[model samples]
Target: MPSSLSIAAFAAPLIQLAAAHGYVSGVTVNGGSWVDGSNPNWYYQPEGTAPDTPGWKALNQDNGFVSPDAYDTNDIACHKSATPGETYITASAGDTLTLYWNTWPDTHHGPVLNYLAECSGECTAATADGLSFTKISEAGLLSGSNPGTWATDTLIANNFTADVIIPGSLAAGNYVLRHEIIALHSAASANGAQSYPQCLNIQVGGSGSTALPAGEPATDFYSSADPGILFSLYTAFTSYTIPGPDVWTA
Candidate 1:
């Protein structure tokens, strides 16, 4: 058995290591803000909740943790498992929403993407397998001397936040919003890319006449074998194709 003194000495370091992993701990919609791990409306099923939920299963996952890297896999879409409550942030078209994460390390450099999927009806009970999504916003590597790296990107870099515009003409409805980051620091090796995807419930109100494009299963986006996901980002890349469908800017 270990001595109490020894155990005490090791406890602090262990706690720090665990806390180092990051997660989206809070979000701001328009002028309203809510913290994660505590907000019932945010859609994260606490790990301590009885009978674990099925959507965004990796809710509150440490930033250091990554899901199985196979494309079109279950964990790729929303890291889902639990059926989140239907509570959502209410916003009109042309509003701004911001997501805040825990400490984001500079070493995890990659692209940031946002997607939206309209719900069939009530979103609180919707299953992850039954949902479909459309690309809405994408931010790739910044252009300059050090290209293909997200380390210097303003929104990502050492910051813990990102902001996105709600399409001015978005139709009125309830939709699932997915925010993601692809960490490519280790993409040179097979199955090395780390993807962190989080989902939220939102009720969008707008007079916009545009309709969502045909929905595709999360697996339809990219294959694990795709070059963009498996390639090394150590060198300069002139242009990058975000690994997903075109954005529906309308």
Candidate 2:
């Protein structure tokens, strides 16, 4: 039998594990639901529910996955081994896309960022290391009146869902939208910030032929010592520095 101290130690990690988990369940493009597990044709097919199975995409399993202590590595891009050959969801360039998560912990307060990568050829064959992403949208701690933290931002706080508008002026083509959440509750410690990123295959439809601006690699997003990821959020603060490339406007 485990001793009282042993039991407490074992329970502590479980508590932490439960607090840090979450995943995007569905992507809504142009009013259609592309549920991850339900529609394998539009999204990567999760290898039945277990992360250890063959064809299981690493980041999709949010049981206890987190990333590098800093932006020194490319793992920040897609979390882990991403599912390839996913069918791209079709949408208009200006449409508003919604990303729905299973559930976000109320305590995990931080910014939400959305990115887009125009595929050079076929998105199904694209790999995380080969794709270049443009910051399309990012929301940080809100200011004014009552003031708002990213955790308390609009529908994201209440519904675990956030929306970003597709750039209307963007040229139509195949692309991947990456929606991410940075949980900073334990960020004061080294490697404490949890970055959850989900990439969705997409095909944009528009007559515009504007070229996307230059962007940075996911590995370039942060450093282990970056103040944003190593700072405390439990005190009085006015603003926040989102730890990625600037949002690109075409």
Candidate 3:
């Protein structure tokens, strides 16, 4: 009887979800100056409604506030004010945070709008750092299978919220929230100027581990342009050296 034989197959693609997780916090813009065509002083307006009064009045209400002066000559001056408890979610390693903001026609401009979560250290209040902003999510901007970029001239309308995903491998610690609108144009002119709105602040917390899996080995075959199996009846063996892992110690 022939000897018992067995073979094992170990060639399969490794698939994974990457262990990246994320969350979202809602933000509310309120309590700013409203430019209605009435009361010259700043007044208050209801949520989600423009000031009904006339003559460019400043609305002190949290929801419907407008600025008195047009920051840019080409663009109309508007105000954006967010509340204290705007951000509500926290994040950790293998996780993300998606910030939801109320949309308006004039809110969507080309600027680096960011949402950052702190893991250990405190988040910076300065607009220079501590935020992660991306272009508005439009179609056909991104090449791969992901959300695209914001379309030029695409204003932030109602029910339109941008998704700010925190990196999956971020460390765990306390986090603060803020936003900035870099003025695209200095003043309103025929050249189409833009102005950025003030940033708001909020706080959150997170805790978790961020460990990654080990690497696997790769296989390859040897090949030569030889016809005869027996040449000098000699076989030579060769070996290769792979670099070792460079570990970092905290």
Candidate 4:
């Protein structure tokens, strides 16, 4: 029951050449840029508020993507079930829950597309990012958690969608769901640093279906159905020195 799982090199590609004109730069993740008063590189903490139970509402500054300098788009947030402790796992009505974004990253700001190229070599881009989660109530939650202190829930918007609802009177076992992706860079005080945080570890079951429980490795490996076989296995392990070929001393 495995259809797809990818996030190794995400989408490795970040080529760039100026004077000669060669472009394809676009790959940056985790190492996008961050430092100096750092605090909002991206965040999400749900299990049960902290200090007491009345705080945790930043959702990346209410969807503005947090801009004291950066994060203009690319965010997602979700939490349902009364919103008190965020709970909902009891399936038995047309069960078919599916939310998948198996860790994606190959470009966000380092493959050099318009940020003055510098990733170098065949263009080894780095960030392509992705994540999603949905399910809201209690005024659509939005992002709140300051009761105990340890609040940080954000969702920018280059892309994000998460919705989970399974309360048909569940009574199974094993059920957990958590997804995260926080890569911030409010301009990093004019491109100094701060942008490196990509996470995804989700598991939702009760007969619904949502598993990313550590299994994402295959970001488009130059597919052609194994035709060249990595250039014929690098020309059969090249070590050419066949003058007259000692053909096994035959």
Return the TM-score for candidate 4, rounded to 2 decimals. 0.19
Better of 1 and 2 by lDDT: 2
125-202: candidate 4 lDDT, tens digit per residue: 211222222211111112222111110111112211122333333333333222222221121233322222212111
Tens digits of per-residue lDDT for model 1 on 1-250? 2233442343334336554434444556674755232222233445456332212434433334444364556567676443554367677778888676544557777778888888899677777777799888888767642334552255544246688787888888888877888777777788887777777777788797677777787877876666767767776667655677778868
- List candidate 3 segments past 4 Å from native: 1-88, 106-109, 115-158, 181-250
Model 4: per-residue Cα lDDT at residue 19:
16
Q: Ten residues in a row with the worst lDDT in model 3?
A: 6-15
* lDDT (CA) per prediction: 0.63, 0.65, 0.25, 0.20
Pairing residues by index, what is the TM-score of model 2?
0.79
Q: Best-fitting candidate, measured by lDDT?
A: 2
Residue 102: error of model 1 in Å? 1.4
lDDT score at residue 62, model 4, on the 0-100 scale: 16
Q: TM-score-based ranking, best first?
A: 2, 1, 3, 4
Question: How close to the true structure is residue 163 of candidate 1, measured as C-alpha lDDT?
Answer: 80
Residue-level error in angstroms, candidate 4, position 120: 48
TM-score of each: 0.78, 0.79, 0.32, 0.19
Candidate 4 deviant stretches above 4 angstroms? 1-59, 64-86, 92-96, 99-171, 182-250
